[model samples]
Target: MGDPTPTNPQDETSTQPGASPAGWWGKLRDRANQLRSARRLSRWFNVDDDKVAEILAEVRQQLPTTEALLVGKPQAGKSSIVRGLTGVSADIVGQGFRPHTQHTQRYAYPSEDLPLLIFTDTVGLGDLAQATDAIITELVDDLSSSSSKGRILILTVKINDFATDSLRQIAVRLRQQFPTVPCLLAVTCSHEVYPPSQAN
Candidate 1:
């Protein structure tokens, strides 16, 4: 982005009078030039650690990111939704997730440094022993603490799976807590409703 301004073709320094005369002297001159270039490069990048961190923080603040929280039972296509949103391969999406809490994982699209969207996956949303109240509390705390404004909740449920008594409770809790946050109902596994011949 920062291209050097062009110098005049007639500029004196632009023209090296001649190639170095061949000898040990030429080799020594080349070595010295290499060292000078290296020093210049090093000096250019010799920024203070604190200053670098400050710049990175500013960049983070400037980049607008949407945060999506995916809450669903097992095999509900939460991972597939992430893959669809990011337009990346499933394996890459699978590997990108980093643990956010005891029961949640986070993934930032493109990169953590400059993400356009960040997704938080609730790991144990519908487990029999899992406490949904704790999950709801954690989500509320996270949403309140986050600097991001664009927050959403995605509820993934398999189309054929009607056993949602537990899932419904969680959805109600989240809606009551974060009324402003938009929610999406992602119904998946339509193949489960079709016969074997039509499933393909």
Candidate 2:
């Protein structure tokens, strides 16, 4: 399409009539206008419109490759869960009481194509009362590249401290931040810490 011919050139002052020729600020303003015009021209078969199509593609590329995030406070037994799921021994697995894993670590599911599943061991986001932004960012990135067949975010705690303020607060925050991310609450050390309810 041809450029938008104004009825009055002098009237193009205020984005209306009597508008001055674009000054510094106006030039910046007109720059966006020029971009829009260029885009319109592209739509009319002038330039390539492929860039607009790449946004979703890029976001998809940025999604997580793994299916789940195993998050909890330090020493909450997330490693134990990982050991159980992967059949890996704790002797080789990194274990700690606060922030056991400093970063997000991906574990491959034992029996499935495309890795069947991915479990991300996030640092003690809920346990250490730390910011989970980096952990969540890693999760989203992984999801972008891989098919998240299923996501399991486990919030773990010791049986002796199941209802601690930190655990409850973290659970609330996780629920609010990721309303759709599937989650499970686990009370670890049950055998040692808390016997059957009837035992008490």
**TM-scores, all models, native as reference:** 0.75, 0.46
Return the lDDT, model 2, position 180.
Answer: 75
Cα displacement (angstroms), candidate 1, residue 167, comes to: 1.7
For residue 36, what is the lDDT in candidate 2? 96
Query: What does the lDDT read for residue 125 in candidate 1?
Result: 77
Clash numbers, per candidate = 0, 16
Could you tell me the lDDT of residue 4 within candidate 1?
A: 91
lDDT of 1 by residue, 49-117 (tens): 999899988888888889999989879999999988879998999899999998788999889988889
lDDT of 2 by residue, 1-200 (tens): 99887577545544652244545567778789999999998878854558755764675456444465766667778778878866767764553222324556655554332354466676645535555565555555644554535566787778776446655555566677667777787878777754457463
Question: Worst lDDT window (10 residues) for model 2?
Answer: 92-101
Error of 2 at 64 (Å): 14
